[model samples]
Target: MKTKKVVVGALAAMLSLSVCSLAPAVAAGETVQISVGKVNAKAGETFSVDVSLADIPSTGIQCLDFAVTYDSKVLTIDKVEAGALVKNGADSKDASASLAPLFEGSVNSSEGWVSAAWSTSTDDASYWLKSDGVFCTITGKVASGVADGTVSDLKIVPINRETYSKSGVTNKEISCGYEKDGKPVKYATTLNNGSVTVGTIVTTTTQPPTNKIVRGDANCDGGVDMSDVVLIMQSLANPNKYGLDGSDSKHITAQGQANGDVDSDVKGITSNDALKIQKWLLKSISEL
Candidate 1:
């Protein structure tokens, strides 16, 4: 019995040691660490940032609240990008500019990126250096707010210190990473992960006026009626205004990747409407 007990104790200790070694060392305190990946970049050009928790607590963080910090003398914030618009009753109106801090003001909102409730000290997570110790910080909240399909394209933008500017155009490539069960699990990059190059971003939105006008009203005489059928055939055949293969170019979006071929919905303004008109016209001719 004594021999068996000794063996069991030894096994338990070995297992514990193995587990400890497998865990990455998390330090104690609040800090912002950054990496530029293993590459060199030109001034006023784009670069990538590899983010992680730093000055970490050794209590073995179930979650770690962190923010990134970097020198802004070498870099500057450019612009803000967005995918969706918030409702009027929602939190904030869509603003296209970057953060503007007061003498001692800070801006880092957690809701802007990732599936997080992270709140920045200032309004948004943007920074430019007046004279810097740490100007740019990609604050991250270490909760599972991103696990339930809540946030999309959660990432950081870090332009090269040598190449960032405010007025002139510059682009930054941001990457994201995460830890699972207190260990490194997964992350993102520009390959399968997305990247936004901060060049010239132009948003073309045509607002609806008091009157909406479209020439071939796909319903009336020139609209969506029988004549529209003949118009569609003409469109398919002639397709070109002056001289072009207008029929060959169409933009269709089905969840994604437009499957528009020569006979399919190239741009969702489908030719099928023309087909419907053809059928209706044939029936009318027969009835007459």
Candidate 2:
């Protein structure tokens, strides 16, 4: 970890001018993507999202600067930390490379936005990030008054000069890529945003009837079987057709969602729930 002032100074110097036009087009057949992870939490609960990178170029990446925005009314950013990709520093193609990356960020809870910059601490190319993994983590707290079922988007956007003026500005676009012979080369990139959904909180005073829930019986046909797995997958892949409020008569209901949430590692009815059901049916696992 680098000092915030030092990191901000380096970022400011690097982004003082726009470099968007100087970047070359992405190579054919090469793909680069940045994504934000999603999760479910209750109002006033603390949560975190992972910012990940995929399909790093053969040359590897040296520096990255990006911003994430959220609905301030529903969430407040707490902290930003370096992730595995920066700390572990393993190159996919080079077994010997061990990078020492530095990370720093600034958060504005009132604006519901946070900006971060990460890079190799030295000019050595060996220190660059060369693998696909999490780049950073953003921790936040959901507003206490938010209602259940409310969803807040965690959107990735360009680092705006005006917003991150203290950190300086290179361009309004997301800056990523490595230096080629001392010159920065940007990558052609794609982005996938994520969200945090407020879930129903079970309290002693009043809660959904747990006794009525038939765990793993997602289809509500009175049995835990492969059909329940199918329903869970369908609901996730085609929510409008098989979701809780789906128009299709075979849509999974609220009870189905509760029943399908057998996997403790994840919240809500995800594909993991479907996999758990399959495992139980195969006798690989005694129960869901």
Candidate 3:
């Protein structure tokens, strides 16, 4: 009887432990995402790509080192500047004793690379990098003699261990993350690469009466007509079909895209812009 009682007690204890193990443990969520915006340029023209981040964890970023590579043959690196997020101190607080941020980056045309690193002197819990916003801007010029419709990649360099690396590619190791309770926390992130394209001049059947292109001429054919309206509608309705993605050389030219602003607002091209263009063509309004 004594032995049976001891066995029952042990079984009960094991059952309790098993039930506890079934409960899920909570983990800190951290994400670093790199996004690129509107990568198109004409030959001999200076253009820029916006790099942004989202879902930044509160552990904040202790240190970050990354690099971007472009084709030197077609493009030349000009310079890199701190984005609004960093300049506004979006990541760190203004409290006294908070670590000051240090930013460093450069454009190396010779190496076809733009490398940047950022960090804070204090790794205390009081500091946190901004959660979301433009991280930096990469400005460059399309090199002369590059053929129209040429496309090139904007790849992230494997500068450190924490930096996202291509599969099967080896690179130097570096650590970056925020501190929690005096302990270092690793960050997980998703990286989105980008590409730049030198656009080709598109010729259309209908030309504007004047030599100058008019506003709302989304096709760059020198005129804003029903065709332009159709084009804009198609682009908005199904961007994939028209190669509206900047990665494709045949994508809508930057000028054409800009001219789509019939609303005369810098907000960006939207369905409303298309509607406004239609209204203008119908003589509903004198100006866009």
Candidate 4:
């Protein structure tokens, strides 16, 4: 038992060293931003929120550690997995190299929070995440008893400071880490929080006239589904290929634009409309 304990202690110490070895160096005025995606779902339904990185530094990031807090009464975190950016970073490295980073994540259901950390096993910049994309995806299920229209906030927080401060690390702020001039460095980071909404399902028999606009029917396909969401996103992201006036035959039509304008306040068909259609499809909302 004593031998086993010693081995365990050694492993823990190694992990701590790996994470803290990348010290936080003062960055110029450049700042990186972390954002959580917004989502909507019905009670008892499973949903995913993406934590993305934007404004990634040219030097890239070798390590990341942060915590996210949510409303436990409304949802329970299932798991957090590596996102596309992390996977791409691994794929860019040598094929024989281990694909997995030194990662650790845990959830405190009672406290409604999750903490996660990831780092390359070595100081190699080739293994660092260099792109702006999803860093992780958090999957959760809405509480069965959650009321319709209920909204839960998801915010980034510093990792367990008291626990990490014991390592003699001067910085416990949530941010990405890299090495500069052989010293560990960190970037100025901005946190953009997100929210999840629980919407009520209402069934209706009324139908709009054939000539009238149908909300969320972006493709004019009589009904809304994942396709409409895709079309809207495509049209917005690449207007020349999918825009209303694009050369493509499948370009969005004027009628499609009118129908896809689910958010009247937004003035035009935007990603918000696509999101509303997605929620409607999930039965989270009664209408677009």
Q: Model 3, range 31-80, lDDT digits (tens) per residue?
A: 56665544556788877666666666654565555677888999987887
Model 3 spans > 4 angstroms off: 1-29, 90-101, 123-127, 160-175, 200-288
Name model 1 segments beyond 4 Å from true.
1-78, 85-174, 191-288
How well does each candidate superpose onto the true structure, as a TM-score? Answer: 0.18, 0.60, 0.54, 0.60
Per-residue accuracy of model 2 over 1-288 as CA lDDT, tens digit each: 112434433433343335333444344565567777656888888776667776777877766777889999999888988776677542343322343226667787777788877765455676677776667877788889899989899898876553233543334566576555655566766887878888753322122335687989998889998999878766654454565666698888777788888987656665567778999999999978
Tens digits of per-residue lDDT for model 4, 1-288: 011122212222332333555434566886777777656678888777667776777777766777889999999999988765677554345342353335555678888888766665445676777766667778888899888989999998866543232454433456466655555566777887777788742222223224698888888899878988878765654454566665677777777777887975344555567778888899998866
lDDT of 4 at 40: 69
Q: Tell me how far the alpha carbon of residue 249 in candidate 2 is from the true structure, in angstroms, after superposition.
A: 27
Output the number of the lDDT-best candidate.
2
Model 4 misplaced regions, further than 4 Å: 1-24, 89-100, 162-171, 200-288
lDDT of each: 0.25, 0.68, 0.56, 0.66
The positional error of residue 26 in candidate 2, measured at the CA in angstroms, is 5.5
Per-candidate clashes come to 24, 2, 5, 2
Candidate with more favorable, higher TM-score: 3 or 4: 4
TM-score-based ranking: 4, 2, 3, 1
Give the range of the ten consecutive residues with the poorest summed lDDT in model 1.
81-90
